[model samples]
Target chain A: MNPKPDKKIPALYGGIIMGLISAIPFVNIINCLCCTGILLGGFLAVMFYKNNFTPGTPPFTAGDCLAVGALAGIVGAVVDTVLSLMFLAIFGDVTQQYILDLIRNMDIQVPEEFYELFEEAMRQEMAGFAIIMNFFFALILDVLFGLLGGLIGYSVFKPKGQQPLQPSPPPFMPQAS
Target chain B: MLLRFFSPTFLIDTVVMKASFPYIVLVCLAFIWCIAPVLPPMLAWHVSPANPLSSQLYTWFSHICHQVDSRSLHLFGMKLSVCARCSGIYVGFFLGVVLSPFLSRRVSLSAIKWWALALLPMLIDIALDVLGIHSSTIVTRVATGVVFGVNAAFILTPLIEESLEKFIPMNWGQRKQGVFYESQTR
Candidate 1:
């Protein structure tokens, strides 16, 4: 158990920084990299929390992991949402049109009977979903990834002496004051 | 009283853990297999104006990726619901979880600092894509996924075990209660 009262602030700061790092353009794309950064961020939070806890505090618990994970998810989600909005605004329509044209060009082998339906299908599918569509998907992914990250972080960075039934209560318990 | 209530859960968890390792891998494989077929329609459904079902379906995967179509996989007749990287992630993750219990001592968490090296494939893939040097083929994407999945599984199981040990805070008496219940049921 750590005796530091100020450690919580640093943990929060770590979470915030991690969130921002995940939100950055391009770098944010690395989230797909096994969610390495996000997981690292969650681990950072546990590291901070561990340092802050008073001596004899129970080593990091699943509950702590979950909390940290949730924060990382929220952070990643916000950044992802913003990026989605931008991606939607640009290149989306062009992409849809490009696919439609490509399919049309490939129509030589395509069934003459099914050609019209196929074209309609491509057009409708690409132009269909709204900005909010992208928003929600980004949000859920970040949360799940964050939760996983938090768990990993807890495992790697958690303090020693945290076994179940060990019951190492904090050193400075308020003595019925 | 608390011990009695929890005894069943522990017994069940232990039994399932011991019995289900191989089955879990199959479950993971089934999940991976399904993704390839379901993805295209789900993606097209989101972008198709004619399909009123698209919006709700789109909402389902919204938190994960832009689902912008190009950044996603094209399976059956359309793009997958999630982005390419995500598809790899879940497929990999499930596989990793399934494979964890069977690993030899060489692959155990404590011995393999090389697990950290697992992050490199993904890093290189994304970096190459960023530089316009290359696009990750489906096979490469999946390969990276498998690597990440293995690493994640290795890291995850131990952490989960540790977390359970801490959060549940069981005593020997508690553990014994579970053991006794299992014996009695048998």
Candidate 2:
């Protein structure tokens, strides 16, 4: 009766959660943990669905894990971008001021020309256009990294006895059967 | 009143030592030690008015750091041990973990296939750069680095998880021992 297959809802939720986490300041390196979070979340969702919906049956497959991974990666990327921006906006000026002050206190002998160039660059960077421009580039890098992480998460933390078999079965399996 | 909430959080932190230790190790090895050792020689080589080791240091760093002029911190003069993209990835990894519980919990490293899609972008970029069809820009270098870095995390996370899981008492120990014993007996 429940043959209409779908893991979309859980996948989306899992993805969003993962994405938001990836956006966090320090904890995001758990991305170093790669898709571990997404896979775990997807597994949690499917397990929850199974436990709550049906008593003792596991309805997980490698493909399900893969799907969850993709979703989480996307969500994580989006969250990370927003978080970086929020942090940048909040702290960027303060950080710049501190750095400039520290340099001055140390009495570092910076050449006049390079100092001018550096100040100009910083000013441009802080300007509306430059920050936005860098953000766009950063977004691309982030998404690709997140996606790769998600895919790897699927590979590593896939549920026991569940994962899309990357290598196809040999041609003669039917004959043996 | 004080004991009510603080105890549980304290206990949770105490129990999560395994989870936190690696990061502590990473902080020491990846950032603290890493930044100091490579920087001095690099700086002395690059910007100083009269420096003897500049050429040697530049050549040495060339193998390790992409050393593209733009994404570098120009002090007395000379790029850091790594390029901007490489630095970004490492620095990102180093700095992006302040909210580990909320952020770490949201994503799982295992759900990703980091290495699977990497071949094409890596190959095309490196080959083209070598062939000189187009110059390797900072953006392109970063793109490649991100791909590789993500893939690296995929490989590393499982090793960490497996190690962590081992600290907990799970019934699989008997089974693991049995398999090992059987193989040795055979």
Residue B165 lDDT (model 1): 52
Q: What's the lDDT for residue A50 in model 1?
A: 65
Off by over 4 Å in 2: A1-67, A94-108, A112-119, A125-128, A163-177, B1-186
Residues A1-177 of candidate 1 have per-residue lDDT tens digits of 443344345445555655566555455555544455666666676666666666565555766776767675666566545654455466444444565578778746766667677556545533436435544555565566666667666656655454322111111212332
Candidates in order, interface RMSD in Å: 14.7, 18.1
* C-alpha-based local distance difference test score of model 1: 0.57
Scored against the true structure, residue B167 in model 1 reaches a CA lDDT of 46
lDDT of 2 by residue, B22-132 (tens): 333433444652364255555575556346565444544442344656855454455565565565445444343322322333444333433455435656776898999
Per-model TM against the reference: 0.56, 0.36
Looking at model 2 chain B, which ten-residue stretch has the lowest summed lDDT?
A: B96-105
TM-score of chain B of each: 0.58, 0.47
* Tens digits of lDDT, candidate 1, B1-186: 446324766544443434333333334454764464364476565566456455555446543356767666765556666667667766766665555545522343332354566678987987898899998776777678668766765566545544445444554444567798999999
Kindly report the docking quality category of candidate 1: incorrect
